[model samples]
Target: MEDERLYAWGNPWFRWSVVSFVVLTVLSFLVGFVVLPSVQRDYTAGGIWASICRAAGLPANWGAGTATDKAGPLSTSVVLAPAMALPGSSDAVGRGATIALQQCSMCHGVQGMSEANAPNLAGQYPEVVIKQLEDYKHGHRIHSFMEALSSNLSDRDIADIAAYYDSVPKARTAPARYSESSAPALVRVGDPLRNIAPCIGCHGGTDHKLGAP
Candidate 1:
């Protein structure tokens, strides 16, 4: 009995069950990949192989060769370098301050902290500032004032502005102290099934996402 148990393939019942399982699996695959997909109106042009690939939910180009569709709009082109995150030299900061005072202080505030509708820039990651400024300069980001002002700025000038803003401290805010029951559903627990992540996951908690302000 022990030898027979160890050599289960020799048993008629076990062998037949294995064969039955394989046959059923092959039949199911044929039905799903061939029969069902072949009859579908969508797969009529592509034939059997395309039908199989479609039924398996393969990418459109996988069965139809390479895609020649035109690409979509281009996004921001700023690449955050390691040096951008590092604190700037005193001279750079001074130059940036001069530029900011002359050009940016009115909207962004003297210390990069905003008191109005404009966004606060104090203590923001240098990369974020660099990216935004670059975007504005290149016309990737559009705003009447920003596009006009950024168009006149050179690369060095943009770097200096970021350095200046980096030198300023951000305004302090009190910490949140919400009970589990009292906290907003979206804040405490995002709807993951729908692909929405919790705010803290990207914004400002333990998991601080890079380049997220």
Candidate 2:
């Protein structure tokens, strides 16, 4: 009689375990299918997914984990102002400054100074600076300078930086003047041009777009 009772109890427990296992398998699978993609997408969008992944014991290897991630288990959209960097700029500035620093400082000089490769921007007009930055950010401007610089910046950040640039004065650099008489051997075939390219091409338009030579 004890054996019979034990058999009955054991059989039921075994069947329950099987059912639970199946259910868990199906649940994990369904969760994988239904939630991973969106969650991965959210993970790309920012921090919320990262928070959830940590909470759920999911790895946030970011790019290295499951192709889709755990799906809809995470993800939340946020309506953010145009992230910018200028203090008191549009909501965008909040997310924009970091990107600017990441990209702009090479030729333009850090903190708005201009290296020889580019022009000084501090003394430029706010409107002109704003326009150029927009041109870069929007692709209207075609130089590698603008294209690469603006590709990732949002409009607001561009404007904020432009405003920042507008607040400063152009740095003082010696003017380049051509002197044919100064050259010991000025030959037409192997000679610097009698007149150097016009400065007007660049600084001449201090209040306008710096045109190319």
Q: 129-171, model 2: which lDDT tens digit per residue?
A: 5566666556665677577767776756666666565545666
Model 1 lDDT per residue over 1-213, tens place: 887775598788788889999999999999999998877766665777777888988876745457777887667888878999988899999999999999999987798765555777888778889999899888788788989988999988988999988889866765444467876767666788887877655444321333345
Q: Against the hidden true structure, what lDDT does model 2 obtain?
A: 0.54
TM-score for candidate 2: 0.37
RMSD of 1: 10.4
Q: Which ten residues in a row have the lowest lDDT in candidate 1?
A: 203-212
RMSD of each: 10.4, 21.8
